[model samples]
Target: MDFYHRAGLILDALDNKKGSVKGLCMAEAKKGRKAGEGARFLKVVVEVLKYRPHIQHLLTATKLLAQEPTLFVPPSSTAAVASALKSGSAASANKALKTPRKHVKAAPSPLSLASVMVHDLLFAKRGLTLPKEHKVRKKLEKYQPALEKENEREKRRRKVATNEGLQIALPEKVASSLEGIGKGKKRAHDADRFAEEGAGSDGAPGEIRWMRVNTLRWTVEAAVEWLEKCGWEMFEDVQEMLAAAQSKPKVFALDAHIEPLLALPAAVSLPTISAYQDGRLLAQDKASCMPAWVLLMPALLDAEERAEAGLLYVDDEDEDEEKKAAGGDAKGKGKAKSKGIRVLDATAAPGNKTTMAAALVATEGINGRVVACERDQGRFKVLKDMLKRADAKNVQPMNVDFLSLKPDDAKLKNVTHLLVDPSCSGSGIPSRLDHLLPSAPEDEQLARIRALSNFQLAIVSHALRFSGAQRVVYSTCSIWEQEDEGVVMRVLAKKEFREAGWRLAPRDEVMPTWERRGRVEACGGDETIADSLVRCLPEDGTNGFFVACFVKDETAAPIAAPALPAAAAAADEGEEDAALEPLEDEDVTEDASAPAVSAQPVKKGGKAAKKAKSTASQAARKAKDEVLGLASAPAAAKESGDAEVKAPAKKGGEGGKKLSKKQMYLLKKEELKRKKEAAQE
Candidate 1:
């Protein structure tokens, strides 16, 4: 792309140029080519010398040649030049060149390159330009008073409203539990979008979710019917889900920070908004969405494995199908719904993609599962809370570490899809997010990064072992070589992983902003994932992210070492389920502030500047080896196909058998069955 790179390519081709490279370089320097090309040319010659015979000794032969720059001639022309020079004659290079031009190549003329500044830009000193304060100061002066007035008015309203007796409320866990989730720092917010305090704490300036509703012959009505039949009652108004689905799904972030985003063709139903809903259509960052398109292409999969997902984002075109193979519905609905397809969220937690995969599963009204897992306790709780609220039925939450999970341990069989959103530095994410975390020392951040990298490697390694996982989306919110391209490179370097079965993926599109990358070995033809990995940056109005896809070969070498011990298998499977013991303490409510909060005020434009911010916590651990391994038992239900209303197996206690809890926060499936039975009576 630049002279430095071009010169490198050119100099590399000079090894076969016959004339001694050093002599030629010296001659070129004398002709004014500069030391840059000379050094490059000599390096190429030395590489050639390593492989060729007498060429390595040519330097010895030309020991005195540089003293007289004219001595540097083509290898074939060298003998004649020497003879003429020894005979006391001024032998010009033209005499040797005129002998018989029999197809020999000419050495590059060094003089023409005198003006080249090969590495100029790579070493340039530059800074970004910003608007001067005076310009904006004058423009914004008019709005200052109005802004002050609004704050004054807010105080008066608060005095009249709450001064008498009113209290604000926090979410489910308590106001105190929201400690780290709130903002601690601020980014330069646009005046029109954010309040003075910034996008956090005081105002819920909530983040937005982009969704795309599926419209296959089955509109959301049909899908909802299927869900209703199966027992899922999302609290959002049914009409609202339908309206939201049909409407162009854009973002709905809270005030404080504004950003424009698009909802994919994903159907955001009522279950997506409530506290127990999948409020935001959690999916991949807009930029990283490419790798799922490219590297881990499931489109190349066989018909059965592709299953319903094979028809992502397609609108029916009866006119095109007869003339062209437009990808729409393949087989009849009945036939298509019988197949078993699955996807795994390898390191899923805080459940973004886990929930998205759930939406896709719900759309099919068929048997598909998303196995989502988290490695840490705090994040694992986040996953639990998210799944509970979103009513994500298709996903099976596992609190197992990815590295500790084996292909078989992933009891979710018949998986055709796998998504590994491993950990990495937040380079791909906006500085706005990292700003949320408190400032730590430089060494601490590095240590955190290294720790995250190790987990990332383990997740990918284990994911690759799953035999049923044909299509995988390996992603990270990082843009480092060690994590981005480097992880891919490490997988490539493993001779067995490469030879056993793996290849670069193909892509249907490339984001222009990231088209210039993928110049490393891991990129597979300079492509990110086998050259198909996609990278997203915050600057692009998308989450900073990286995504790569991989296709597994069924016939490739197996990736197993030994079977897991029986005891370990049981422990791993039952551990998390054993963790949710009920708190023995009494519920602690704010003693004095419960009055106004209990009223559920329907005020107008109330979430403005949730500015007077404050930040909140709880912990419980279960003990092992209880009596009879049963905490308690009872409460049974009717079994229907794959939809069993089996409650979470209670903790084993004095008698060893586990019991069930009250259905206050029941899973969708069980709640539905219970409701149906109650209605009939």
Candidate 2:
């Protein structure tokens, strides 16, 4: 009836393997007990169990239980109680023990109840919240000093500084002896870890399984209710949810950064959940959701009228669906009025971001189209299947290399936004996840990174080439600076990128609350560039990831006058062009600084138009350089000193003479320098 009695009964059930710590506490709450009281009881039971081994050791070391024999239930009394409860014959076993509330003073205290009292006196910060006249309180007060002294002695023996330390440093022998002390077999380690600290003493946050509520099928509120109805308890704070999950079956918490996301215990069987199977809940990491959210929501939602001219809006008939997806009718308001917006997913395979973008666009009532392109045949099929499952009606899937698509083509010319998520080393994804890509040796890995970096840079540069494109969201599931910040640096260094009016979106327009920004050093120590990018590691409760948004400012003068010579401008072109080339019918010159002079009728804007034509000619020339493999000529010249390094002819034949030690060392040094330069490039 009382809190202590309730807690003792729960502990007794645990000892008898009747139920889990949370299950028993929840059972009490279901039986008309106050929710707060139930939580208190569960906390007490878990704390007692967590330190039960140490508490028992201390009790044995001090002989306190033996000295106060009447303070605990006897072995014979415990058996009689267990049998009475099991056989539904409480009166038959001990009629005198009926009505425990009135007779508790006369009966021996339950061993678990007595242990709870001892734990409070020795360890609880706010010790013993019971009345002074209470019999158990009076008994515990008598031996409080002795119990505290023994606890100190044990800590000193174990060389621990505090009670928490002593708990962590429990002797393995003592721990093995009480393997089932306070938690279920399935959650023994979890309980131990929770008791030590929320995420262990090292302070790395525990992994949480994140799911996004698919508003198309149900709202966040509906999803929450569905989970509760299915027996999962929700917590207001992620930390509290993690603690409860230690000895509980079903619990979840809302993600603070992303509104529509929920964090569940890692052990939850997600595939078996009805919501997941029905496609009402999407299995996605918090980091993976950032790109689409940035692209479709806060970043571009500011211009009300721009929505009409270029953005998409949901029809009034789909108003309720929009509200459901956005979490409220108020949030779903402000649909951009205008011609529908179009997006291109340059590397869209398996379509997670594609679906996410589609959802956000629909929820915001934006009239938008998403074109998803996958180069691989197998992944193209998977992308189509995902789009079908997600019900992304507006997306058009294509199986072709994104690089092969010309910006001026009819299919992509009107594309207003682009999502460029290309392949990388995949160092960000954990091995525990479904896929296990083979690892490469150090030398091969470096070479692979170089290749991947070039590819990523090329993809972003091509996205910037879309004349009608206003924004581009670039992302990768990679922790490497070379693939993330390195590619960003190279893109920003390009003459055409700025001429195209592309600039890194400010942090406020990005995911600002996200604490882990891109590596500042990787962005050449520029705080602004770093802030514009987002990064996630396992410690942040997501995979290692990097995402950045580039927005084209219409006010920017695309053909602004330059302050450089032609040769300097040509040499400053981005490195990605070395890995990209022009398609058929495009004419280009071999000279890096020479313009690809196409005799198209020049637009009649005079000086400004001529400047624009020259820029285009230069761009065409660079494209030709890529085709001719001359884009890397500058780097090669730097490495080999504008001429090939060669050994002089031998006295007899070319291979007949041996070189001196100094000459051999000089040749090796030059080779090493060339390799180093190649790596840097």
Q: What TM-score goes with each of the models?
A: 0.38, 0.51
lDDT of each candidate versus the true structure: 0.38, 0.61
Determine the C-alpha RMSD for candidate 2 after optimal superposition of all C-alphas. 24.1
Candidate 2 local lDDT, 174-206, one digit each (tens):
233223433444343434322211100111123
Please estimate how well model 1 matches the true structure, expressed as its whole-model Cα lDDT. Answer: 0.38
Backbone clashes under 3 angstroms, per model = 43, 8
Residue lDDT tens for model 1, 1-681: 123223332343332221222323323332344433343333322222222222212222333223333322334443444455466544555565466646433432221111011111111122111133533223323333543344345447557443112122223322222222212221111111121111111111113223222221224444445445644443243234334445445212211111112332222232333321223322233453343333222332333354546533221233236235535545443332334456677656556456656655544323455677665554466567657655676678876655444464445556667777654444553322223122457755444444344335445655675766666667776666556665655454444445446543454333323553453443433433434666655444455567666666658574332222332233223323321221110000000000010111122343542221100000000111011111111222232111111333444555543222212212222334434555534
TM-score of 1: 0.38
Strongest candidate by TM-score: 2
